[model samples]
Each structure stands twice: as structure tokens, then as C-alpha cells.
Target: MFARWVQEILRSPLLRPGIRSGHRTSGIFVPVVRGSSAAGKIALLERGIILSSVAYLAFETYKWKKGQTVVHASIKVDDIIEQADYLYGSGETAKLYELLSQYKDSNDAELLWRLARAARDMALVSTTPQDEKKRLIYESFDSAKKALELNELCWAAHKWYSICLSNVGDYEGIKTKIGNAYIVKEHLERAKELNPKDATTIHIIGVWCYMFADLPWYQVKIASALFGTPPSATFEEALEYFLQAEEVDPNFYSKNLLFLGKTYLKLKNKSLALDWLTKAKDFPARTEEDIEAMVYVRYWYI
Candidate 1:
């Protein structure tokens, strides 16, 4: 109730795509100090920040809980969706691709389903080994696209296809990956156009830029001279992209809080990160796969 009131008071109509109007991420809430008096307010703020800082931890909680749910899945396909989500959410590109490859012989009708799943997976992993993941990504994407072409479900493919392409940017070595960078970028841009209001698309773009802006821990010596100059909108742009995404798809990730919190830490901003992480910690949808994402987001600067 209070959160909604604050959102009503502060929401900017112009903010793109849309701001997530929720109570803020749980992991981020630790740093908050909400109270009646000045001291209480200060205390609240601090605690909220701490809570927010644990977005990664919160994400883990969600992942753990989610894994438990998947365990109870009644069927193979349901179990596959659960498993697929875990891999995709955690950013395990190589493993995700391998999973798709395993299902290569899926019967014709199931092909699109598996491909769509893989495309969604591609949107999460780093760009380095994308060459490694590409075959599966393409196969899956083509499968979905073909199905969509035959039917009218093509719209659904837009977001996942875009994601599959956009996420390849995070792989280890990208200078020589043929049909790699361009392929993903094309789909991503297309997604933005097809469904500019979608949260998944925004999240996809945000993750791509944030991960790239951070770069490898060891590459500073060689690329700092050029990449060091920093792209004016790279990180901030990603955040902008993601914020809009949240407005469109609040419940999409179940890990959105963790993503936002980690990105804030990258910017050396304290308050926002806390707000997000704290929210993540309290998620009822926790999954074990989310731990992978939490591990990546929870750490400082690395």
C-alpha cells in the first residue's frame, strides 16, 4: 500500500519502457531503514540498502525454490521447461546449447517447442562460446521461425529469437565468430521493433550491454586504451532498456531484482542495488538454478 502510494507520487509518465512499480527487490531492502523518526529513517535506509545488496542471494533463494517446484513437475516436457528455465536464467550458454543438442531428434511437432526454448536460452549466455552454441541456436531459431511462418505464432518467436542472437555478445571470443554478432543483433533489434514494450527484450538488451561493459578481468591491459574510453550510453543505456522491460513484464524473470541489483553495483551506486537485491531475497519463486545468477551478481565489481 505504502509502496504503491510512493510509486503513484513518483512515477514519471515519460520513463521508458515503464518503471517496475513493485516494492523494490528484496535483496536491496536490507539497505533500507524505513521508520518514523529521523534516526529511524536513517536506520531504515541503511537496512534497506543491505537487503538490496543481497540481490544475488535473493536470486539464489528464488532459484532454490524454483528447483524444488521443478522437481514436482508431473511430466517430461514440464520438467524440460523447468530445467530449460534454470539453465537460461543462470546464463549457462554452453550447457543450454548442449541441452538443445540432446533434444535434436525431437519429433517434428516438438521441434518448434524445443527451438523456441533454445532461442530463449541463447538470450542468456555470454558471447564467447557462442560459436559453440550457434548451431543449436540457429537450429532452434529456424525451427520456431519455420513453425511461425506456417502458422501465426511468429510473434512469440520475436522475443526469444532476438534473445538468442543478442546474448551471444557475451561469449568469450567474438572476433571470428561468423554469422554470430550480426545474427543476434538483427533479431534483437527486430524484437525491439516488434514488441517495444516487452520486458524480456529489454532484459536481453540490458544483460548484453552490462556484461560487455564490465569486460573480462584480465582484458584491461590490452583494450583499455580503446574500450576504456567507454561508450557513453553502454551501461546506463542497458539500465534504461531494462527499466522499460520491467514495466512491460514485471513477473517475467523472477530474477529481475538480481539483474537490476548487480547492474547498480557495477555503476558503484549503493541505494538502487540494495533496493533490488533485498526484493530478490524474499522471492517465493526461488530456484536452485538462480544461484548461478546470484553468484554472478552478488559479488562486488567482479
Candidate 2:
């Protein structure tokens, strides 16, 4: 009886497998047996399970590949930054600039600020034409500005931006230089506030104080005309900043030593002036700035 029922079901028109255009039916084939209905349902469930597993595996594979790519990219960026820093610390400004200039359009605030610093240093030591020097300085300023825009809290960005701003003022005339004085001070203070341990930022703040303290009478008039309350500092204030910088990092910068000597001279302390000037002259000349410091010491002191 069971055999007869199976035969009848297989002979049914609904259960018959037919070829259309000499092609098999585009569907799962299930045998029409005693329990054809149940068998069909089971086959469908198995197909669904197989397809779900394949899709799950594919999705997991995609995620893993994406994660690995992101990690690799991060490591590459870190390596580049580390190499750039090494070049900079070694005082290879040209090499540092060459390495970092390739990434001038990078979105990384860290890279942009460092690139700006390299460009500024290059401009300082470059014997290029005046127009070429101006172009480089302006480029440095633009890079620093972009870095600040990308990250407001970046201490290095703020520091470089302020330095580049001051550099730009050199070509813009005395009025512009005096006009940017307060802006430069503001950014330097912000940079110091963000990272108090940065000896370079502290030293720049000291320079700011020194410049205002020794402002010429005509420039002072220009500053007065530009702002209602023009920035003012005394030789004593400049001395304090320079001393604080030295305390933070002893013998870190030759220029800082030179400024200390000059500030003491302004205050009429011949003994301290001579002492600091001697130190400045004796400081090692690793970079152009250090060489300039030695020359300044000799010209003004010895």
C-alpha cells in the first residue's frame, strides 16, 4: 500500500519534473515519496541554513580585512612621524623638510605643524633670493594655520603658528610686525598653557617679553596707534622668562642664553651680562641658529 501511494504521488501532475526549452527546472529537486511534503520542507530549511552560513562567513572576512588595513595604515603613519622626528632632532633640517614636504597636504595636524617648522627653519638658513625666502615663510605660515584649524588643542600647532606669524610680519613692515605682537603673544601663551613642559614654547614666550621690553620709541608709538592698550614688558619681566626657560631645560637653546645676556645688559648688570654672554659664545654650534647666537654674543659682548 505504501509503494502504491508513492507511485501515485510521483505520477501526479504537480509532482512531475518537466524540462522547458531542454533545461531542468530552476529549483531544488526533492523526491516525491511517501512523505513528499515533509521532505520538501526539510530540503528548503537546509538550503536556507547553508546560504546563511556562507553570508555570515563572507561578512566576517570583510570586517577582518578592513581592520587589518586600518592597523597597517596607522603603523605606516607612526613610522613616518618617527623618522621625521629623528631627522629633526639630528638638526638635518633639509632632510627633514624633504621627508615632510611630501605630506604637506596631509590631514594630520602633527605632520602639518612639523612641516611648517621645517620650512621656517629652512627659510631662516636659506641664502635664497628675498622673494623666494618670503614665499617659503608664507608657505610655512599657511601650513601652520591649517594645522591650527585641524586641531585647536595641539600645542605644537599653536607654537608654530605664532612663530610663522611673526616671520611673516618681517616682510609686511614694522606696522604689521607691531600689530601681530599681541597675537603672537596670545598664541604662545596658549601653547605654553597646553603643554607647560615644552621648553621651546617657554623660550619663545621669553622672546616675546624681551621684544616688547626693548621696543624702540617709534615702534612703541606704532603699537600705541594700533591698539588702545599696547603690550608692554620690562627688562625685569624679560629676565624672568629667560630664567624660567633656562630652569625648565638647562642649556637647551643657545639663543635663550644670548637673550639672557642681552636682557642683563639692558638692566645694567654688567657682571651677569658678561657671564651669560660667555656661556652663549661657548655653546656648541649644531645648527644655524646656534651659529647665529655665537656671532651675536661676539658682536654685542666680546
Candidate 3:
């Protein structure tokens, strides 16, 4: 009777997927007498044990397959990152944003930071209403903050976080905006320390210096009142950072060229200013930023 019960269980449709022919099965065996009145109860208990064993094996197999799938997915992430980088290099900001936005909830710090950058870029170039533009900027800031939380050591996270934080200040009051300057400077410096060769990070530091150096008298007083010794830098300091960024990656960004020109103008060096402004004007207008750079050159320097 026990042998007949075992054969019936092995042929059951419910267990077919997990238990195939020639698959070894092992479990605790409870012996039973052939003519005993308790045979039915023993058989039921035996059946329960078999079902439990099959369920356990199925769960283990599922776990193994799930792990394999995770490994494959991680490899695909690298390919996606490469594709995103190519889009960015071509100044395809819209395409880059579309691709990375799908992974906004991803746990990867690298992808999150890149997404933040794309969102911020879109916000900068967006022709949408003010409320929509503000939404995008805040979204960018959230993504950057999330990336930083995931990996404090990620330099790109620090860089984007600083940029997004500064962008958010536009909607915030001037007092909050001015207060965030020191925080922005700290993150930019941290980013520079992590990756000194990044031209964009260096360029942004120069922008910070230029902004404070050119602050009007009333704003200067506000800053000084708010934070004792307010942040200050000279045109000479801003010029040095811009030049260093250029040295690291010449013509990498049109804004850098425009700023170099602006800094020279502040220093009363018209010859150098004109040289840099002309370069900015001639830069290919592949994206909105490049177009804006050209417009600035024409308006202020031409």
C-alpha cells in the first residue's frame, strides 16, 4: 500500500514541474504495517511530508534563478550607462533625459546622479511655464540628494547635488539663496577633491567665485550681515579657475568660454575678453546652452 501511494504522488500533476523523472528525492520515512487500522492516518502524514519537500525544492530553485537574473541585469546597466554617455556627448539632452528617467527609482548612485544632471539641464533649457520649470528643478534636486544618500563618495553625486541645490535657490528667497552659497561651495570643493580632472566641476567653482566677486553693494551687505565674513573672491581668482578648467579640457563647455570672457571684462582686459567671447560665439549651437552662450556673446561682447 505504501509503495502504491508513493507512485501516485510521484505522478501527480501539481508536483510535476518541480519533480522530474530521475530527480532524487529524500525525506524522513515513517514505517507502517500493511493491515493496521492506522494505515490511512500514516499515509496522509506521509503525503504531507512529500508535499513540503517539493515546495522547499521549488523555492530554492526560484531563489537561484532570481540571483542569476539580478547578475544579468547589472551587466545591462553598464551598457545603458554607455549609451547615455554617448547621447550626452552629442548634446542630446532630451534623449539622455528620456533614457535615464526610466531609472529614476534605481538604487545605483551613478545612474541617479546622471539622471539629476539631465533633469537640471532640461529645466535650464525648458520653455515651459514657470511652475513646470520649478517642478523640474526640484525633481533634479531630489534625485541628486537621493544619489548622495546612496553613495557619499560618488563625486558626480556631489557635483550634481551642488548644481541642483544652486538651481533650487532661484525659486527660494534671496536670503535662502545667499545662505546656500557656502553649502554649494563646500560640495563643489568636495567634488573637485574627489576628481580634480573634471573640467565641469572646476568651471562651476569659478562661477561661484565670479558671482561673489561681482556682488552689488547691497547684496554684499546682506551677505555680510547674514554670515559675519561673507564669501568673497577676486576676478583674478575666478580667472585662475576658468583658465585651469580650460587647461584641463579646452572648449569642453561654451559657458566656460563665456565666463572666461566675462571674467576678463571684469578685470578690464578687453583684448583677452574679446578673444574668449569670440570663441564662445563661434561654438556650435548644438543645445540650448550653446545657443544661449552665443546670444550672450552677441549681446554683451559683440
* TM-score per model over all chains: 0.47, 0.72, 0.71
| Over 4 Å off, model 2 | 1-75
By lDDT rank, best first, the candidates go 3, 2, 1
RMSD per model, one decimal: 16.3, 32.2, 26.7
Q: Is 2 or 3 the stronger prediction by TM-score?
A: 2
Clashes of 2: 0
lDDT of 2 by residue, 1-302 (tens): 54354335444465333200111011111000110122233454454345443332322232224333211223345556655554554455566676677677889999899889778766654345667668878989999999999999999899888888887887787677767877888998998899877766776777677777777888678778877678887878878878987887687767778888989999999999999999999986544445556756676568
Q: List, residue by residue over 84-167, the lDDT tens digit for candidate 3.
A: 555554445566677777678989998898888777666654345677668877998999999999999998899888878877
TM-score of 2: 0.72
- Candidate 3 wrong stretches, greater than 4 Å: 1-75
Local distance difference test, each candidate: 0.46, 0.66, 0.68
Q: What is the descending TM-score order?
A: 2, 3, 1
Tens digits of per-residue lDDT, candidate 1, 59-145, equal 233223433321222225444444444444443444544444444455433445455565444432333264545664455556655
Q: Which ten residues in a row have the lowest lDDT in candidate 1?
A: 26-35
True-vs-predicted CA distance for residue 125, candidate 3, Å: 2.9
Q: What is the lDDT of residue 192 in candidate 2?
A: 86
Better of 2 and 3 by lDDT: 3
For lDDT, the strongest prediction is 3
